[model samples]
Target: MELTTPTGASILVNLADDFIHGFAKMKVKRIGYGAGQSDMDFPNVLKLYLGEASGRRFNHDEITLLETNIDTATGETMGYLFEQLFEEGALDVVLVPCIMKKNRPGHILKVMCNQADVEQLTALIMEETGTLGVRVMPHAHRLTLSRRIVEKKVVVGDREFKVRFKVAFDSAGVIAFERAEFEDLRRISKKTGLSLRKVREELKS
Candidate 1:
């Protein structure tokens, strides 16, 4: 796809929502919005649909750094660090063996998690290990397709809930889909004498 700017320059892009083998092609249908954080420099909204393009899309970006070297920590101690991090719901944890200053063999522990967990986890690391400090950086969060729906019911006797696409992606990979709220779902189920799952499924359909 190509876009003409006010200056008369053209910008081009190509991407796909998914691949359908042996098919001619799929074109973009629409874009959907999700949400945004108040303090974000970039829009917090999620885009639901992808536009039509001639081919598949690829992307990469530059980034800032956050690193530190620790020489005195032990293997058993490192195990504790990883366990604590995992218990706290860290995104990732790894340790690379390396030779540090004075040619001492050691491990370079790397921990990666959401920006929100950095401060508290860093404090835990400092308190639990010999590392004196941590390096911090402002990072970027990627937007992806996500959605959920719940059944919301009228007080009289209906089950339904609004399903808006969310900015945060769920493991099932839905951008926006339907749902049924419990309160309404329960009442609807009671009124119709149907199981909760059956009521939810019917309402979704």
Candidate 2:
């Protein structure tokens, strides 16, 4: 299948012939349906489900971590590699400075992704960095909080814009913290000609 973005960039994805499958752990609370106009042999409708994560109550599936040490790669090359990894469905990418063999300074590039995308991401890393081999730790368990995005409007100067906040909750459904997205705050600061600190203060109040 081919997917195209708004900027005309395209991505080609292959599917298995036997079955199409995806894994998600969620606690479904409500389900709704929308009817389609097209009449066909089967029901023409769309299903929408709303739910929260199962949280600590259930055993969650593990994610894969791919790591490689690079001593000869340049910073610019690593930066480009990170962008590609994100575009290819990496959950997270981290680069840490460390000392390799022979007391040489280098970086440890770690990538987190699901099992489905491990092969593709690993191949991209190898092709981009020329790393002889990558270390893979499959089935690494992750503890994540349940989170959702909420919008709040803040007035800066004579204009107002909505800022999205990430609200995280505990397993018992209690809110842990809510913080405005940094990119949103930065955009507000640029438009209002205010310091980032000022924008944050205003949002807080």
Candidate 3:
């Protein structure tokens, strides 16, 4: 299928053969069915359901957590590892400073990714960081919010620029939180010769 916007931009979508696909996230409360056209060999019907989801909206999925302690890797090397993990489809990466068993100062790197990407990411960690072993905790469930980015126009000084905002909604369809993207604010501040705080406050107003 193809879709075109007023500005002449286009989007193309291709579906798999012999399969139906849809994307939706909702809570199921009540269900009802309706019968259609009686002349067919198979029953034709439509199912309807209703529900209420309050608080935060989230989806359940399993993820893998990979961790390792590195006392020898340089700060630059660790930074590169972080970039590599993200490039390899890691959901999140975190580093925590710690003291090892031998009283050596070290840092613990934790990587979160989908179960399918575990093998590749784990191998990359070993190859890049040269860690003797990586501990993997599979079957970890996560609840993630549904999020989207919207372009907003903000004025700084005498000029206007488009800024991206992240909007989050709760399960009850209420806006849980909304904030301007930091990168946009930083860029605007540099261009307008304003402090980061001033730019942020101006955008908020």
Candidate 4:
């Protein structure tokens, strides 16, 4: 019975530092698994565990990056693709303008997503841009901070508005950064007849 393939063995050898006979108590953050192709009596799957050991401070994760080059897509097509990708659970999508071969202006579409979403997102990119191939870079390490939304009450002239701000905290529970939601700001600006820049200034003050 072959339990581990060459790739699996190599991963274990390179990644594992210690081995134990019994399980230890820990907090599990996430669980991921890959399906195996075998007709076995038992469930054939390779599972990966992400956990926080005792007294651990920060959180770490891995994500998949998918990129493709598009020279024929119009602005409207790019906008639709962005909406679809985000609706399909993409963590972030960015388009970088570049010059392709023959001095053709193009854009590089980059998508960040979880490993589970790699397939669908790659397909979406191909379908949207008509690209024959999409580059997949899996297991990109990521360090993330804890984030929460805080509601703030702001008085703009005679109007009082409640705005939501996203606050990020470091491992030591100190604030790293805070950003107001742009949609909220845009709405406030439209209603108050103030320019978006003026609204931002009011928030800063």
Name the top TM-score candidate: 3
> What does the lDDT come to for candidate 1?
0.60
lDDT for 110 in candidate 3 is 95
TM-score of 3: 0.70
* lDDT score at residue 159, model 2, on the 0-100 scale: 84
Q: What is the C-alpha lDDT profile of model 3 across 128-177, one tens digit per residue?
A: 87888989986798886667899988788789999999998754456778
Instruction: Report the poorest 10 consecutive residues by lDDT, candidate 2.
Output: 10-19
| Per-residue lDDT over 1-205 for candidate 1, one digit per residue giving the tens place of the 0 to 100 score | 2223344332222343444566434476776786744546665565556656433232323232234567777788889988998787666778888889898888776776776677778887887777897876556444334444433333322634332322333444433434345666676677778898886677545
Candidate 2 TM-score, true structure as reference: 0.67
lDDT string, candidate 2, 25-127, tens digits: 6788999998866677777776766788564542246899999998878889999999999999999999999999999999999999989998899899989
lDDT of 4 by residue, 80-178 (tens): 999999999999999999999999899999999999999898888888888898889867988888889999999875799999999988676878789
Candidate number with the higher lDDT (1 or 4): 4
Q: How does model 4 fare in lDDT?
A: 0.88
lDDT of each: 0.60, 0.83, 0.81, 0.88
Count: clashes, candidate 3: 0
> Candidate 2, 162: how far from true, in Å?
1.6
Candidate 4 residue pairs that clash: none
* Best-first order by lDDT: 4, 2, 3, 1
> Predictions ranked by TM-score, top down?
3, 4, 2, 1
Look at candidate 3 and tell me the lDDT of residue 131: 87
TM for every model, in the order presented, reads: 0.41, 0.67, 0.70, 0.68
